[model samples]
Target chain A: MTSVLGPLALATSTGALLIVPLAPALRELISKRDAGPLVTRKDDGNISSFAASLRTRCISLHRMLDDCAKFGDNQLIDLSHGSAFVVGQSGAWAGSHHPVALVACAGSVELPAGFQSIADFYCRGNVRCGQQSIFRSLLSEEEIALGNDTQVLRWVHAESSLSAGRNCRLYGRASSAKLLTLSPGCSFERIYAPVIYSSTEGTALNLRTEYAPYARLAQSGIGRTRVHGAMHFPADEEHRGDAVATRNIDLEQGACIFGSMKANGDISLKERAEVHGSLVSTKRIHISSGCFVKGPIIAEREVIIDSGVQVGLPGTPTTVSAPLIHLAPGSVLHGTAWAKTEGRVGD
Target chain B: MLLGLFTAVVALICIYTIRHYCFTVNRIIGQQRHPYVDVDTAEWPPVTVLIAAHNEEAVVGDILTALLEVDYPAEKLAIVPVNDRSVDRTREIIDSFVVHYPGRITPFHRTGGRAGKAAALKDAMAYVNTEIMLVFDADYVPGKALIRQLVAPFFDPEVGSVMGRVVPLNVGKKLLTRILDLERSGGYQVDQQARMNLHFVPQYGGTVAGIRKSALDEIGGWNENTLAEDTDLTYRMLLAGWKTVYENRAECYEEVPERWPVRVRQIMRWAKGHNQAMVGYSALLLRSRNVSWWERFDGLLLLGVYMMAPVLLLGWLLAMVLFYLGAPVGGGLAVLGLAAFTTLGNFAAFFEIAAAARLDGSRARIQLLPLTFLGFTVSAISVSRAAWQQFTSWIRGQEMVWHKTERSRVAPVVLEKSA
Candidate 1:
C-alpha cells in the first residue's frame, strides 16, 4: 500500500505540471467575460474621472443601490440618501493618496469657540493618551467663531472600548498653546482628564466660492472629502492664451459656471442662452436657424476674414471679431458677436 | 428475444428510410419546385376569399380593413365572411364593413342548425362565384400582395391547392408565445419546405390556403366527418390526381392561441381531425388505380406513422432495453434511428424556422428559437391528446368541439386621422 501510494503521488505531481500550461488561457477567457475599458479623463467634465463616468448615472438612491449591486463596483459612495458614508479600501493605484478621505455635509460645519483653525480643534490639553480615548465636547464653528468659549474635551479610559470604536485620532496644534518639543524624560499620561478650550480667537468653517484640486483629496478606504461650497475657475482674456488648444468642457448643470464652454474660436452665445460646446468665433460668424450649442463659443475680437458663414465645427464654434466683416444678404446671427462698437461689416 | 428485437429494428430502419425517401422525392418534385404551371398576374383569375370567423370582434374589423386595402382590382376580388354565431360584436363589425364596402363585400351569417366550421364554410361556398377560393381564418392577416402570389401558381393547370406561409402574431408576449412562434417557424420554414424539397409536401394548414373553387365543389366542398377538414381535403385532392403546391412567399400572420389551455384544445382538435383523415383514407393505400403506387402506399404509411407515434415511441424504448442487455447490437441501431430523427430531420426543421423567422424581418421573434424545444414538447402532448380523443371519440361515438383560436388587435400600418 505504501509503494502504491508513493507512485500515485508521483503521478499526480506530473499531472499538475501539465495543467500549468492551461492556466493562463483559462484565466484569460474568464477575465474577458466581465472585462470593461478603463475610465479616462475627457472633454466632458460632468464625470471627469473615468470610473465615475461609466456608472449608470442613476439619480434615485434605491436605483443606485440596485445598479451598484448589479454592476458589482469595487467601491460605492452612498451620498444619495443623505446619510453620507465612504466605502471600500482607501488609497490610490499609486502611493499617491486618493482624493476623498472624509465626506461631510455640502455646506458649512459649526465648530466650538477657542479653536482658531482645523489644527486647533484637534488638539486640547494633550500630553499623552491611550487607545480609545473619548474626546468629548468637540469644538464647533458656531461657538468657536462667536467666541462662546464653552466647549471642552474629555478623554475616555477603557481597554476594550478601542475594538469597535471609530479608531480615528486628530493631530494638530492648538492656537493658544506654544509648540512643545518633548524630551526623552518627559513622559506623561492622562488617566481621567477633562480639558476645556478657552480663547478669544476661534476657527469657523467657511463656504468658499472656489475649491481647487482639493476635491480629489478624498481617498476611498480612508473616507470621503467634500467641497462645502461651489468651486470656481477664474479666467480672463489676457491670461487665457497659455494653451492654444482648448479642452472640451462638460458643464455640470448644478455647478452653473458662467463661462462654462470651451471653444477654439471666440464664443458668442445668445443672451440668457445655454451652449454645450466651445465656441470659436472667427472673422466670419454665421448662425443658422434652430442650432443649439450647449458649450462655449470662441471668436476673434480683432480683424479676421473668412467666407464660411453659419458653417462651423460641431459643438460650439469660437467666434473671432474682425475690424471689418462682410455678411451675405440673408445671414442672421443669434449668439454674441465681438466687435468694436456696433459690430458688423467694416466695424 | 434480443435477436428478434434486432431484426425488428433493422426492418423498421429499412422501412423508415424508404418512406423518408419517397416523402422527400414527392415533395421536391411536386411541392417544393414549381410543380404547377405559372400564370400571368395580368391574366390572373378572379378569387373569392372565404373568411371563417367565430367571436373575432377584436380583429374582424382589421381583417375587413386589410381586405379592403388589398391591392387587387375591386372587380376581381370578393370577400365572404361566414360569421359562426359569434356572441361578441363580430357580426356588427362585419356588417359595418359591408355597409362601407357596398358591392365589394358579401357577409354570410350562420345562426344555427348544425354548427361547424366546415358546415359554415359549405353554406358560405354558395356566395363564392369565382374560379379560386382563398380561405383565411379570422386571425389571418393577409399580405397586400398575397392574392397575386397565391394566384400566380394557378397558371399551373394541375395545381389543386396552394398553401401560403402562416406566421404567428404576438410572438414576443411571453416564453410560451415565443416557443409557439418558433414551432410555427419550424413548421412553415423547415418542415413544410423540407417536405416540399423531399416531395411529400403535406396538407396545407387551413389559414392562407387557396383551393380551386371548381375542384373543391367537385369533391363536395369540405368533409364535416373529420375534425381536420383541411388535411382530409388535402389528401382527397392529391388522391383525385390534383397536385398540392406550397407557396412560401405568399405570407399571412395568424394570431396564435397564447394561453396554454386554448393551445391544448386547438392541438387536440387538429390531432383528432388528422387521425380521422388517416383512418378514413387508409383505403387509399390498397387502391392504386387513380394515384401513383408511391403516393398510395407512402400516404397510408405516413398517416399510419403519425397515428401510431405513441406505439412507435414505446417500441423504441423496448429496443433500447434489448440493446443494453447485450443480446444483439440494437443499441447502435437505436442511436442511429434517434440521430436521424432528431439531428438530421428535426434539427434541420429547427434551423429552417430560425432562418425563416429572421428572413421574414422579425428580429424579436427570431430570439424565441431557444425555447423551441419546450414548444415541441408541448406540441407532442397535444398530438397525444389528439390521438386519445380520436380513440375515445370513436369508442364513445361522440364528436368533439371545433374551437376557434382568438386573435389580437393588429397594429394599423396606415393611421390616418379624420379630416
Candidate 2:
C-alpha cells in the first residue's frame, strides 16, 4: 500500500515536474525565428544606408518577420519569409566558391534570404525544389531515377553537384590522416559528387589513375580531399580484390584501404585490399585470404597474413623487425625485410 | 461510535493538510519573479485591440479614450469596436471617435443581436491582421501599462491565452461590493497566481485576456450555448494543449454588481455554465497530452468547489441543529470549533486578497480588511444562491439564462478612441 501511495503521489505531482523543466523546452520548440537573412532587390525607392541598418537591426530581433518598422533613421520592410540569410543589404558576397564540407553529426545548415521554399525544405515540408539551385536533390540522377521514392541523402548546399558521366578517382593518401578513407563502392558518388582525396594536414600526393579519363584531384579549400593516413588499402569499385598497380584487381568485401590507421587501430580484412602508403601502427594488421598489397608495412606489435598473399617488388626481400614471423604454407611474400637480433622470422 | 470519531479525525487532518499546502504554494506564487533575459520589447509585434460592446454607451467612450493614450506605437495600435445591438448612444460615441481618430479606430455596429459577442467578434476577425489580439469587455478601464503586460507572454509561443488581473472599480461603493471585489481578487490574483506559479491556470478571465488569434480559430470559435463563454473557451484551449498565463502586472478595473441579487444571478449563471462544461469536457481534459497533470487536477478541483461549498454549508447548519437538539456540551464545543475553523478559512482567503491589492499599488483598500468579514457573509449567501441555481438546473435539466452583468455605474475614465 505504501509503495502504491508513493507512485500515486509522484504521478499527481507530475505537473510540478513540467513547470520546472519541460515548459522551457516546449517554449523553445514552439518559438520561431522572427527574422532571417535579408534578400534585397536593387530597384527600390530611395532608401538610405542608415535606414537599411536600422531595418536589419529590427529584422534581427523578431521571432518571425512581420511588419517593417521605421525607427529614427531606419526603415524596415517586412518580407514575412520563414527563413533568411543576410547577404549584406549592399556589398560583396564572401565565403563563396569554397568547397562545402558538411559535417553531419546533428546540426543545422541555414539558407540565405528567408526563402520560404528552402525553409520549407529544411522543415521537411512537402514542396519539391525544381532545378534552380545547387542544393536541390532532384538534379541527382539517383533521385530522378527513384522519382517519388527518393530517400533523403546527405544534405547539399546546392543542387548543382550531381552528375553521372565523369569517371573520377577516389583521392587521398595515408600517413597521419587516419580518418580519411574512401567510402566503399560508388553508391554515394551519385549524391556527394566524385570522391577527391584531401590531406588532413598540408601535404601533396601524385595521384595517377589509369583508364579513368578524369583524374584531377581537389587542390585546395576547406573541403578539398587530401592524404593523411600512411598505411591503408585502395579497393576497386567492385568488392572482389584490391587495385594492385600491375593487375587492376577489384577489392574484397569490406576490405577498402585505410591508412594512417591510428596507433591502436586494427584492420579486419575479410579479403585484403591494396595498400598504397606505409603502414605505421602499434596494432595488429590482419590480412585475410586473397590479400594483395604494394606498400611499406610497419607495426609495433605484429602483422597477420592469412592465405594467398602477394607483396613488394619481384626482387625485394621480406623484412620483419618482430621477434617471430609466422607464415602458412599457402601464404606468399616478396620484400626486402629484416629483423633485429632479438627478433626471428618463420616461427 | 469509534468509526464516527475516526472519520471525524481523518476529515480534520485532511482539511488542515489541504489548506496548509494551498497556502504554502500561494506564498511561492506571490514571490515568483519573472526572469529578465533582456528580450527586446521593440521587436514585439503590432497588436490589434478588439472590444465588443453591447449597450455599453456608459463606458464605451472612456474605454476608447484610454486605449488611444496607451504608450505604444500609435500607427501599430488599431482599436476595433463591434457595437452589437446597442440601444443607446454607444454607436454615436463610437462614430465620433472613429471620425476623430481616423485610421486608428474602426467601428462596426450590428443592429440585430444575431449571435452575441462571439459572433460580433467573428465578423471582425478578418480585420485583425496583427500578430496578437487583446479582448476586453465594455465595462473595463485598462491601465496604460496593461496592454504591454498582457501582450508580453505572446513572446512565449506556447502561451495561447493570457489572463490579466481584473480589479474592481466599485470596491468603495458598499461593504458587500467591497467584499465581492476582494473575492474576485482572491480568485483572479491569488488562486490564479498560485495556479500559474504551478504552471497551470484553471480558467481564463474574460476581460483583459489576450488570446492568440490562431488558437482562437483552432478551437472553432466560442460556444454560444455556455453561460461562461470565457471559461468554456479556456477549457477548450487547455484541451488543445495551449498554455494559459496569468499576468499580475496587467490590470483592468471592471464594475462589480452592486446588488446581491444581481451578483447571485451572475455567479449562479457562471456555476451552471462551468458545471455543464466540466461534464461536457471531462474526457477531453483527462485525455489532454499537452497540459500538466496539475492543471488537470486544478481544473477538476475548481469544478468541484461549487458542489463542495454547498455541501459544507449544509453540514455546518446540520451541526448547529444537532447542538440545539439536546446534544452534549462536548458536541456543542465541536460545533463552535467548526465555526471558528470556517471563519479562519475565510480569513485565509481574504488575507491573500488584501496582500495582492496592496502589492498592486492599491494601498487604500488594505485598511478595509477589518470589515471584510461582513462582506464575506453576504458573499456566502450569494455563493449559496449560485450553488442552488446550479443544483436546481442540474436536477431539472433546465437551461440557464445567461445573465449579463449590469454596467450602469461603471464608467471608463478615458476613451479608447481618440475622440
Candidate 3:
C-alpha cells in the first residue's frame, strides 16, 4: 500500500498542478448556454429606447450655428447652396444669390444690387425691394414694396396690400387690396405658374454644386495650360506671360502677375502681389497680406486669405469657392464666397 | 520510471513542435483571403464608438482627438467615452471634451462598479444606441479611415464582429517595443489573415474592433467575470452562430510598453486571461455544433497556447533529471530528430515575424529576429508564473485580482511631439 500510494501521490500532485488552472474553464464550458449571463440585470436597459432618445438630440446643420456669434442675432445669412429659412421674426441678409424663405421678418430684406430675378421668394413678412426687382412668386403675409418695372411670373398671394411701382406685370393670380401705379401694356398670362416653394426641413444642400462648373472647366483646361517647372513672377517681371505650373506656384514678396495664373497644386502669394486675372489651383490657394486678386479665385481644397488681402474685382461680383475657406481679420471679399465647411474667420 | 518520464516529455515537445511547424507552413502556403465587399459611403449605418479609459489621462486626449478627426459623417456618429473611476485628470479631460462637443461626445462616468475593463464596458454598453459599436483602447490613435474600413465588413449580414490590425507607434523607441512590433506583425499579418482566409476562427482584439450591437445583446452583452472579455466575446459570438472577420486595411497605431517589466506584466495578464478562457471554453469548443471539426481543432490549439509554457518547462526538468540519473532518454537518432524538430518549432515564430516584416516593406527590422528569443524567454517565465497563480487561486476558490499596467508618464508627450 505504501509503494502504491507513493506513485499515486506523485501522479495526483502533478496532475492537479496541471489540471487545476483549467478546471474552472472546463466547468464553465460544460454548463448550460445561459448559465452565465453576459450582462447582469443592473446593467441591462432598453437599447432601442435609449437610441431613439439620442437620435432626437442629434445635431443638425442649423443647430451647428448655436455657438456662432452671427446666429445670436435675428439675422439670417444664406451660407448654404439652398435657400435659408427664417423661422421667426428675423432680418433676412442674402449674402449669396441663393433664395431666401421668410416665415416672418420684423426688419427689411436686403438683396444684392442689380438682382433682377431671384430663384423664388416665399415671403411671410413685409418685404421692401429696390427698383427693377423681379420676383417669380411673392407669397407675402403683410406688404411688399417693389420698385419701378417689376414683373411677377407666378401667383401673388398678399394678405395685406402690395404697393408696386410703374410698369408691373402680374402673370398669374394677384390678390391684393392695394396695387400701386399701373403702366400700359401690362398683360396677365392665362397659364397659372405653379408656386415653387423649396423645402427647408431636410439636410442642407451640397455647397459643392456651386463650384462644379468651375471644377469641370479647370479639369478640361489642364491639357492646354502651359507647364512650368516653377512659378515666380517678380514685380520686375509683371509683363511675363501667364504663370502656370503643374506642381507648386510660389510668388515672392511684391511679385505682380499681370495675367491669369493656374497651378495644379498649391499657389502661395506673398505680401503686396497684384494678380490682374483669375488665380486657380487644384489644391490650396494662400493669399498673404496686402495682396490683391482682381478676378475670381477658385481652389479645389482650401483658400486662405490673410489679413488685408483683397479678393474679387472691385464693384463686380466675383466668387471664391473651395472646400475650406479661411478669412483673416480685415480681409475683404467683394463677392460671393462659398465653402463646404464652415468658414474659419480668424481674429 | 525515469525513462518513461523522459519519453513522455520528449513526445509532448515533439507534438508541440510539429503543431507549430504545421501552423507556420500553413501560414506561408495558404492563399486564403477574406471575401471582398464593396460598401458605399451613403449606405453606412449609424455607429456608436465606446472608449473605456482608466487613469489614461496622458493618452486619452490623443485618441479622442483622433476619433473626432475620423472621416465619418458627424450626424451618423456618436462617441461615448467611459471613465472607469480614474483618479487622475482622465475624467476632467473627457469632461472638457464633452463640454466642447456636446451631443457628439457623450461622457459615461462609472463611480461604483467592478474595477476592470469588462465591467466598465458593460456599463457603457447600455448607452449604445446604434446598431454597430466600435471600441478603441485609450492608448490607440486610429487612422482617419478606421471607422470607414472597420464598418465596411458589416455590410455582410453574417459578420457579427470585425477586427483591425494594430501597429505599434513606438516601434523604434527601444528593443522591447521593436520586438513587440515584430510580434504584432506576425500575429496580424500572417496568423490572423491566414486564419481568416482559411475559414478558421479569427480573433476580435478588444481595441480596434467593431461589434454588432444586436449580436452582443443576444449574448447578453459583455461578460464581466472573464479578464479577457475580447476572447470571451469572440467564442460566444461563434457559438451563437455569427461570423467574425479580420480587416487588414483597417490599421490603427497603439503604444507598446517600452520597459521590460511593463511588457512582462502585460504579457502575464494576457496569459492569465487566455488560460482562464482556455479552461472555460475548450470543452464547449469541442462540443460546439456550430463549428466544423477543423475549426474545433484550431480553437483548442489557440486556447492551449498559455499551457505550452508549463508543459515545456516540465519537459525540460524531466529531461535534466533523467540525464543526471544516467537514464537513457531516447535512442540517439530519435533524440536528435526530436531536437531538430523542436528547434524548428521554436524558431517558427521568428520566421513568421521575419516574413511579416518583409511583406510590410520593413526588411531592415528583420535583423532583430534573434532578439525575439529574449522576448520569448520572458513570456515563458511570465506565462508559467501566471499559470501557477491561476491554479492556486482556483484551488482556494478566489477570484483573480486585476493588475493594471502602469502607463508611461512621458510616452504620450513624445508621441505628441512626434505627431
Candidate 4:
C-alpha cells in the first residue's frame, strides 16, 4: 500500500502543479497578440459618429461607382436589394412603384409630389424631393433640397448644402458641410453645418464677447470656499468659473458667466444671459430669448432654446444636445443641435 | 469575543464583495454616462504636462517625445519634466531634451525642500503658468487625443480634477505584467467607469490625470506629509465638494512592475499611502454635509480597501482559535463562513476582471482567470504587511518613506502614435 501510494501521490502532486500553472502560463506567454493598440479619436463615442461613418461610406462608394455607368434616362434601374425609378429631366417620377431599401441615383433626380419612399436615396449630383415626400434617408454628394412638408425618417446628409422647406419633419439627423437652411415650422432632431439657419427670420447675432470682467473661476474664489463648497455665482458679478448647484441655477437677466454650469435640477438662463461655456443638467435646461451660450448644452430629459438665442460662435462651434429639444424661432446654432428623441421648431 | 470579531470581519468582507458585484453588474448593462465625451472642437486651455521622474533615466525621453507629438496646440502646451532628486542620468537626459526642443521642453530639477513626488510637484508648480496641470509618471506613454479627452470634463465648472485610464504597455513581458494588465483593465474599464456612471467619487490616481490649478490651490495643493499624495488629494477634493471626474476613453500606457519584488514594493507603498489617507479622511468624509449619502458610503468603502487585508487575516486567525476552543463553530454558520472564505473571497474582483476582459474584447486572455489567485496571494500578503507596518508606525510615531518601485525598462521606449 505504501509503495503504491507514494508514487501516486508524487505523480498527482506533480500533475496538479504542472497543469494549474501551465494554463495561465501558456495564456500569458504564448497567446496570440490579437488585441488592437489602445487609441482614442476625437469622436471616440460621439453620437454624430454614425453620420460621419455614413459620409465615409459614401466616399468609398463614390470611388467604387466611378467605374460604373451613369443613369442615361428615366428607366427601371435594378439594384442589389430592390429597384429604383429614374426620374425624368422635368423632375417627375417614372416607375410604377418600387419599394426598395436602397435607391442609388447616378445623377440628379426629383421624385413626384406626395411620394413616400422608405429607402436611403443617394445622389451624385444635386437632388430635389417633391412635396410631402417621405424618405428613409438622403445622402447627396453635391446638394439636397427638400420640398414642403417632407419627412425624413432617419438622417439626411448633403456634402455641399441642404435646405428643408416649411412644415418638414426631420426625424434623426440633417447635416451639411457648407450651409443648412431650415424654413419656419420645420422640425428637426439633429442639425450639423458650418452655418445653420434654423428659423431664417433673424440675422446672426454678435458672438464675440469681452471676457475682461469674467476672470478664471480659479482666481475669483479664495482658497477656502474654492473647494470646500459648491459655487453660486452672484448675479451682479460677471463670474468666470464652473458652477454646480444641488437645485435649480437660475441666472438672472444680463448675467454673464465665462465658465460652464451644471445642475441637478433645471438650469434657467434668463433673457440676455450669456454663458461662454457648456451647460449640463440632470433634468431640464432652458435658455431664454436674446441669450448667447457658446455651449455644448447637454441635458438628461429636455432642453428649450428661446428665440434669438445663439448657441455657439461662428469660428468656434459647440453642440446643444438633449433627449427633447425645443427651438423657438430665430434660434441660431453654429455647430450641432442633437435631439435624442424629439425636437420641435416652435412650441 | 472571537465570534463577534469573526462576525464583524465577515460582514465587512461581505459588504465589499457585494459592492464589487454591484459595480460589475452596473458596468455591464447600466446607462453609461459619458457627458463630456463629445466636446471635440474647443479652444483648449493652455496646459502644463508635468512629468514626475525619480531615478527614471531609461524612460523620461520616451514620454517627452510622445508629448511633443500629442494632438494639442503647440503654443498652448508646455512639457515640464520634474526631476525629483535622482542620482542617475534622469536630470541629464531631461536637460538635453530641453536644449533640443528649445521653448517646448522645460525641466524642473528639485534638489532641496523635502523629497517624494508631492513635494517635487509642489515646487515645480511655482514655475508653470498654465491653468490646467496634467501629471504623468516618467514611464507613461500617452495617446494623441489624451490631453483633449482629459481636458473636456473641465468645461463643466463642477469638475476640478480628471483622471484618465492607465493601461499597461509592457504586457506579454512576463506573468506578473499580464496579471497586472488584467487587473488594470478591471480597475479602469469597469471599476472607474461604474463609479463615473453612478455619480460616485472616482479616485484620481496621480498619473494619467490632471487637476485645475485653481482647485489644487484651494485644496491646499499636495499634502507632502502623506505618502500617497494622490489618494490624499482625491479625498480632500471630495471633502471640499469638488468632483474628481474619470475619463475611460482617455487612455495612457505605463510600464507595470515585471518582477515580484518590484510589484510587492509598489503595492506596499500603495497600501501604506491608501491606509494613511483612509485614517486621515474616513471620519471627515462621514461628517461632510450636503454630499449625497451614496458618495459618503462609497467614499468610506474606498478608503477602507487596503485595511481589508489585515481584517482578512484576523478572520482566519479567529477561525483557527474558535476551532481549538471547541466552540459552536458548526452548522450553517460554518458552511457560510467557509463558502465566503474559499468561494466568495476575491470573486468580486475576479468577476470584474472577467467582465472587463469581455468588455475589452480580449476573450483569449480570459483563459488565465484561474491563475489570478497567485497574484492575489502575493498582493494580500504584501498589503497585510504594509497595513500592519503602517498601523504600528502610527503607534510608534514614525513616518513612512516614499517607496519607489525600481523600473525594469533597460532601454528607452519608442514613441508611436496609432491615430
Candidate 5:
C-alpha cells in the first residue's frame, strides 16, 4: 500500500498542474456575469424626449396639489426641489426661483422680472422668463419668450413660436414647433424650428439664385489643391462637381459651386459666392454677405455667416453647425443652428 | 521545398501578429477620428430600411413596431421586410405589420429565390426608392435615433458605405456569449475604429450599416454567389474608389449565438465566404490604382482576416511534420505561437481585447481573457476545416450553401429592449 501511494502522488501532482491552465475559465464559471446593458441609448440631444419622459412619469392634479391646496387647484404644491405654483390668471408678475410655475391655458403669463429657477417648470399656455433668470429647463405647451440676460442650463421647448431677447444665454437645445427668433447680444447652443430668424433680414446678393451674364462666369475646374497646399477658385467661376481640398479653400467673390465643398483648412466663401451643396470643413467656415449655402454647413471650429446671408430655403431647412457660430443681424437660417460652445446673434 | 513552404507560412503568420500589435498600440494612443458623429442636425435624406428574414416569426413583429417610432421624418422613412421563402409564419407576421402601419412597413415577399441573404437583398433592391438603404437583421433591435445616426455619413459624397457597432443581446446566458461579447467590443471599439483613423479599411458588416444606392449600382448590385456578401461588397467598394466609414458610437443590439455548435457553424460559414473574396480580388486590390497606398495594403490584410485561422492551423501541422522528419525548426515555434494567439483574442489579439475593454469602460469580466485560448483553438480548427472544404468544393465545381445561426427569445414583449 505504501509503494502504491508513491505512484498515486505523482499522478495527482501532474493532474493539478494541468488544471492550472484552466484557471481563468474556472474563475469565469464561478463568478457573476459582468456584461453591460445591451441597449443603453445615447443622449440624442433633443427637446421632445424631455417632455416624453415627464409625461410618462406624471402626477395627477389631485396628488400634485394634495398638500398645498387650502382652496382649489390654483394653489402651489411643495416639492422636494422647490414649490410648484400653478398660475391661474394671466398677468405680468415677478417670478421666483423656488416655485415651479405652471401657467394656465386661460392666458399668457409674462415673468419679465429677474429670478433663478432651481426646479423644472411646465406651462400649458404661453410664458415668458424674466431678465437674468437662470433656469434648469422649461417645457411649454405654447409659445415661449425669453427676457434679456436670461440663461437656461439644460433645454427649453415650446409648441408654438418662440423668441429670445437681448443678452440671453440659451444653452443646450431650444426648439419650437413654428418660427424661432433670436435678438442681438444673445448666445445659444442649438435652435430648431421651421423658420429661424437669427437677425433682421437684410438685402444682399443672392447666392442661391443664378447670377446673370454667363459671359463673366467661367467654368471652374473645382479648384485643385496646389503643391503649396491651398485651393483658390478664381472669381466669377462655376463648378459642376464637388470641390475638395486638403488645405485652405478660398472661393473668390461671385463664384458658383453647384456641388459639395470639403476642406481640411479654413473655407472662405467670398461675398456673392454661392454653394449649392453641403460645406464640410475641419477649421473655420466664413460666408460673406450675399453668399448662400443650400445644404448643411458644418465646421470643426467656428462658422461665421455675415449679414444678408440665408442658409437653406424656406420650408426646405438645412443645418449650420459649429462650436461657435457668429451670425450678423441680416442673416437667416431655415432649419437648425447648432453651436456646441457659443453662438452669438450679432457678429 | 519543405523549408521554403515553412518560411512562407512563418512570414504570413508574422505579418498578421505585427498587424494586430500595431492595431493595439495605435488604438490606445491614436487620434480617434469620428468626424461624422457630431452631425446631428442635417437635412436627413430619405432612407429605406431593409430587414431580410427567413423564418423570423419570433422576432419580426417587434423590429417593425420599434422601427415605426424612430426619430426620422414620418414621410421620408420607410421599412421593407424581405421574406425569403420562409415556410413558417414569418410572412403572416410581416403582413400583419403592413396592415397596422399602412405606408410605413412595405412587405417584399419572395416565394422562390437562390436561398440566401444576398439573393433576398438583390430581389428587394427594385423596391427601394431612396438614395440611402440601411439593412438590419430580423433579430436586431435599433434605438430611436439610430436611423438618423446611420444616414448622416451620406451627406459626404465620398462616403459610399457606413458601418455601426453591434452589441450582443443575450450576453449573460452562458460562457460562450460572454466571450462573444468581449470579441464584439474588441472588433468594433478598437480594430475597426483604428482602421478608420489610419485611413485603412473599415468593413461594412451587412447589418446595421448604410449603403448609397448609386454606389451600389456602380458596383453592379450584390454578389449573390458568395456566402459572405458583406465582405464581398466591402472589397468591391474599395476597388471602386469608394470609402467605407465606421461609426463606433452608433451601437445596435443583436442576438449572438449561445451554444458551441451554433458558434462553430457561424465562423465556418464566414471562413468559406471570406476566402472566396481573398481568391477573387487579392491581386486586383494590390494592383488597383484608384485607391491610396494605405488602402491597398490594409485592404489586403483585412481580406486575409478569416483565412488567418486556417493558415495558423496549417503552421502548427507543418511544425509537427518538420519535427517528425528531424528538420531544424528554430523560428517555427514562434510561428506556431503567433498562429495560436490569433484565435485567443476577442476577435484577433491578446492586446486588442485589453485595449477595447479599456476603451469601452467594461472591465468586469476581463478575468475571462485566458478562457479565450480554448475558444480560439476551437475556432482555428473549425476555420481550417472550412477553408479546406472551400478549396475542395471549388475544384469539384460545387456551390457553397448558406448557414444561419438558430435563435430563440425568452421575452416576447420586450421588442426594442435587449433579450
Candidate 6:
C-alpha cells in the first residue's frame, strides 16, 4: 500500500500544474463569450458628420449665397491689384500681401463666385461665402480702420497685417458668419460657421417655446379630438390645434394620422401608425412596433421606441429628447436623439 | 492510495476555488461594459402582489402596511396575503387590512393544503388575474417605489422574472446580523448583478421578485415537492428560454436571523433545498437544448453552491490529519501555491462585499466584513450536517420534513422606528 500510495501521490502532485491554470483560462473564455458585444464610446465624429451631411442636404450653399448677395453692398469683382482692397472707405493694408480682397465698406460682403486671387480677405461686419468659394483670411469687422503707413482702399476698410500661407483662415471678433467650407485647419474667433456645427446643445427642441403652446391649446379644448381610428386632415388643419387626450392617447394598430397630437398623460402608438406630425407628451411616450413618425417627438419623461419604428422625415431629420430613451431591437432612427440620463439600445 | 485520493481532492478544491474567484473578478470587470439603468415607464400595468405567510403574526402587519403604501395606482394594484394555516394572529391582521381596503386587499386563507410556501403560492395562483405578480416573504418591508421597479422588467417580452436586492433590517442589532448583511451584499450586489451584466443566470431569490403570469403558467406553476422552489423555478425558466434579470436598484429591507442556531437552521434548509434541486434538475439542465453551453455550465455551478461547504470541510480535515501525521501535504512549493489560491478564493468574498458596499454608498458597512468568517464557519457546519442528514435519509428511504425558521416579534418595533 505504501508503494502504491507513493507513486499515486507523485502523479497527483504533478497534475496540479496542469489543472490549476486550466480553470481560470476556461472561466475567462466563458466570460469573454458571455460579455456579448463590446460597448465602445459613441463615435461623436460619426454623429456630427451625419448631422452635418443631413443639414447640408436640407440647405444648399447656393441658396445661402443668394441670400447673402441680397444683403451685400459691394460685390467682389477681382483681386489682381493688391492684397487689401476697400470698396467705399479708405483704409491701409497693414500686413504682408493679399492676392484678392473684397472689403464691404457699408454693409456685409457676399462672395457669390470663386475669387481665387485674394489670399487675405476682410469684411467690416458680415460675410457669406458658398462652397468652392476660396480665400486666405476672411475677417468681419464693424469698421476696418487703417493706421499710419498702411495700405488702405478708399471707403473700403481693409487691413492686411495677418499672414495666410497655404491654409484658409477666418479671423475676426464678430457675431455670426455663414461660411460654406470649414475645414479642420481653418481658425475662427467667434462666428456661426455651419461646417463646424456639431453640438446638440443649442439645437435641442425648446420645450417652452415650441411645445408648451400645444399643451396650453389642449387645455383650452380647441381642435381637440379623441382619435379612435385613422384620421386625415388638410394642410389648413395642421396648426389649428392639438388633438389632446386627457389620460392616454392609444393609437390603435394600423391607425393613420395626418396631424399633430398632444397628451397630458402617456401616448401609445400601435403598429403601422402613419403619423405625419409631431407628438408631444407630458409623461411617457411608447412607440410600438412598426410605427412611423415623420416629425419630432418631445417627451417630458421616458421615450421607448419599439422595433421597426421609424422616426424623422425623408429629407429632414428630427430630434427625440427625453430623460431616458430606450431603442428596441430592429428599430430604425433616422434622426438625432438625446437622453439626459442614459440610453439603452437593445436587450 | 489514500494519499493520492487526498491530493486529488485538494487539487479539485483548489480548482473550484480559483474558478469561483475568476468568476467574481470577471464579473467586476464586465460591470463596466454593461451598467444597470432603472426602468422608467409611462404606463403602469395591473399587478397582483402575493404575500405568503405561515405564523408570521409579528411581521405580517408591518409588511401589509408597507405594501399598502406602495407608490402605484390604487385601481391597478391588487394585494393578496396568503394565510397558510397560521395558528397565530397572522390571519386576524390580514383580515383587518382586508376590511380597511375592501377591494385592494384580497386575503387568501388556506386551511388544508400541502403546508409549504410552494403549495400556498400555487393555491394563490388560482385567484390572480393580473399581468404581473410580485412575491414577498412576510419579513420584507418594501419601499414605496419598489412595486414599480419590480414590475418594470416585465415590459420586456423575453423577461420572465425580475429579482430585487435585499438589505437586512436587523443589521445593527447584533454581530451575526451584521455579518449576514455583508454576506447579503456580496451575494446580491456583486455576485447577482455581475451575473446579470455578463448574461449569466441571475437567481430569483424567492422574495422581492416579480413574475409574469403567463410565463409562470407556461412553466406549469411552482413545483410543490421541491425544497428550494426558487432554484427549481429559476432553472425551469431558463430551460424554457426565458430570461430572469436582477434589478439592484429595486431594494427591500428584510429581517435576517439574529441568533446563531436560527441562522444555522435557515442555512441548513437552504442547503438541503439547493442540493435537492441539484439532484433533481442537474441531468435535465445538462441535456437541455434551449440553453447555451456556457449557460449550462453556469447553471450547474449555481446549483452546486450548497456542496461547497462540505468540500471545504473535507479540505480542512485532510490538512489537519496530514499535519498530525507529520506528512508534507504536498511539497513546500505545492502547498504554498495552493495556499495562495485558497487565500485568493477567500478574499473574493471580501472583495465583492466591499465593492458592493462602495457601489451602494454604504462605505461604513465594509469595515464589518472581517466578522463574516464567523457566519461562514456556521454556514460550513450547517451545510455539512445537512448534507450528511440528507445522505442518511436517502439511505434509510425516509422523507424529509419542511422545517420553518422561527421569526422574532421585533418587526413592529423596527418598522415603527423606520417609519
Cand 6, B chain, TM: 0.92
Instruction: Write one digit per residue (lDDT tens) for candidate 2, span B1-419.
Output: 42244236436534643743584456445445231111112223578898878888888887888788776668777798878778889899999999998888977788774455666777778778875789988877776667766765554334568888776666545555656665676666567777766655546877788888767776897677777777878888887756677876566777678786777667776766777777777777778765567777777666555554554566576566656663554557657756766666666666676665654445444455555665656555666777677678779998666556776564454222211
Give candidate 2 misplaced runs (Cα > 4 Å): A1-347, B1-25, B28-40, B113-116, B122-127, B320-337, B361-364, B410-419
Name the regions of candidate 1 deviating beyond 4 angstroms. Answer: A1-347, B1-40, B197-199, B293-298, B301-305, B316-348, B351-370, B408-419
* Candidate 2, residue B239: how far the Cα is off, in Å: 1.8
**lDDT of every model, 2 decimals:** 0.47, 0.49, 0.64, 0.78, 0.77, 0.61
For residues B43-157, could you state the per-residue lDDT of candidate 6 as single tens digits?
A: 3568999998999998999888888887788998899998998999989989998888888798998999786789889999987988689999998888777887787555344
